[model samples]
Target: MSDLPLRSQLAVALGRTAAKMSRLAGKGDGSVIGGRIGLRLDPELLTRLAKDRKLVLVSATNGKTTTTRLITSAMTPLGEVATNAFGANMPTGHVSALASAPSAQYGVLECDEKYVPQVLRETGASLVALMNLSRDQMDRAAEIWQLAGKWRRALAESPGTHVIANCDDPLVTWGASTASGVIWVAAGQHWREDSWCCPECGGPLDRQEGEENSDWACRQCHFRRPTPQWALHGDHVVDPHGRQIPLGGIQLPGRANRSNAAIALAVVAQFGVPPEQALPLLAQVKSVAGRYTTVEHQGRTLRLLLSKNPAGWLEAFDVLQPAPGPVALAVNAQGPDGRDTSWLWDVDYRILRGRPVFVSGERRIDLAARLEAADVQFTVVDDFEQAVMSVPPGHLDVIANYTAFQDIRTRYGRVV
Candidate 1:
């Protein structure tokens, strides 16, 4: 901060002060507000703070927060890491995070899919990690292909920054393929609905059957999944050296987290940290922004999981407790959560057919109607806490969309 120009230094100071006040007032994490204030004072605050620091920008439709948390943890042993611990992904959050830890040696920033290009250009990040891309917050964000195009153009312009990208998602591959240096990771992609057509030629994408992690190719064009230098092979991550490193006992659940861990390890390896050393650090991250937090409320154990879109819900279902365990599904069409509930139809509610289910949120009726069509039995309890209480007094899994999940976090006194 001292090295920054007078205006940027003042902006940093004011931003930190505002963030402190926000925390004291119990308003919010202070990242967003502080960032807004800082940017208003100094438009170039992010670039000024990013000077001389090795930074990594992570962007994806799903797993951005978790992957950023994992990367921060893996990089912590090297030095103090400046990161937005909360799910603040825009430029404002980036400013707040860098301002809060001005002297940190490194930064790991989680960027929203739409803001990736802008943040990438602003921060001049040395490494950009691209995970899977899917349709999310359709009413608010750009189409997946448009975002991929932006990323491709951004990387083309910034030739010095290396890219770590998921090869499974064709859109991500197409975006990162233009980078001068790219470490492609065969991070698994569960959501294929959004990437059925090749972004390169608008051709039908063909998936090779029986192949390990089925390879995708364009039926009408030359675009195809690049052979990954780092690939997630079953329970282990195959590094660039072809050495299989086990993803040992990572506290975060599901294959999605395993993919995140693999991506994190790949990112840390760029800094010369061995996968053997980083995997243990990645395992230390139990919860990311309260995504996998479990708490006891009113004699009932509630395991909270956040599923914003169909892809996220698909992964959440994999980590859910065995069938017959009461499950609560909450959703909201709030501003933060794209005001369209049509994405609910993209999820397969039939999987919850045999299980006891409860729906709650501003859009509980929409969710209930979807469940009805899927043959899932559910009770609509408008109150989130009451919905939890209505379930049997035992262990229950609660899956919610963005705002609904935040509401649960607020009710439970902010699970971190």
Candidate 2:
């Protein structure tokens, strides 16, 4: 803390005041803007806050926020964990989270995919969790392979960091493959469009018929899925010998979260928390930010799920279609959400064909067009709050991209 600049100290003070004012004005979470102003004032703020903490950095394309929450939940048995809640993966938000919990020893951070390497370089985090990689925000993100390449190089450079990586994803496997101390976890990856080939040799990965360890070996290069210390074998996350680790209170729905729990459980165990101890803590997390939170907006209640890309959309598809009521699929091409809505074209919206679909948001037209092409019937609800209410009553399912997700959540809490 002594190494911090005078300007940096003043910046954090001002940023906290602004955050309090933002909450008073009821602007929003105030995390993003407050951190933004603080970082603008003190560019080195994240480094300072990250110092002297046993940091666990979680980065992934799909499950960063929820997984970070899961990690935080599990690690509570260990001690105080400082994590950036809401959608605060950016540098500024990282700074703000640390500022809020100034004395917390365990910092569990959800680093944005693009910002992971920078955080690793600056923060000196001891444990780095690299989850699956997939296409997202094409306008802003590097090609998934490029991002994996960056991780590979970063891990190679930082040999002391213990890496927790998903072996199910070829990209993630390739990225942390060379890390000195890697605990591979079989976190499932359904989205494989971008991970079809070997990241090392660029050769087609061998998925031969009835082949053992095709999941284990790349026929072309040295790169292969390392033998995982932990894995999800069907329902239960198994042990080193393939024995089941009883997952009793996993509250988050679907296999995606189970996979997340498997990874999170493995991660905290490294931090000295046992898997059995981890589950009960992780299970208490019913919703993350607003991923699975039911928000009552304008007298209409909906369980909001954030779906940004095809992979994310796939995860929410199971949740949305199985619900008792109509499903609303909202989309937008805002800057926070990439302006390119072409990614929507790649999503399998055809699964919603039999269900009533309520499409809304800035680029609802683009989504509506995609749904139309998929033969899915949808009504374009221009007024978002009405769209939120328009869905059939009782246990409603509403899945939205980034901006639209935040819109309903903020409105539900009186923020407009």
lDDT of each: 0.90, 0.82
Alpha carbon lDDT at 396, candidate 1: 90
User: Which tens-of-lDDT digit does each residue in 1-416 have in candidate 2?
Assistant: 44567888887888888898898997866787888888888888888888889998899998988999999988997778899967688888888898888879999999988887898888988999988899899998899889988888888888778899998888888888767898888777767777778888888776533321137457787877777888886568886666688665787887788888888988998888987788789879998887887766545567888899989998887666463357877888889889999998888877776676788889988988888898988888888666656654555687889888887777675221
Pairs of residues clashing in candidate 2? 213-216
Query: Cα-based RMSD of the predictions, in order?
Result: 1.2, 2.7
lDDT (10s digit) by residue, model 1, range 71-145: 999997799999987889999999988888989989999998888788878888999999999989999888889
Question: Model 1, residue 327: what's the lDDT?
Answer: 95
Overall local distance difference test of candidate 2? 0.82
Worst 10 residues of 1 by lDDT: 207-216
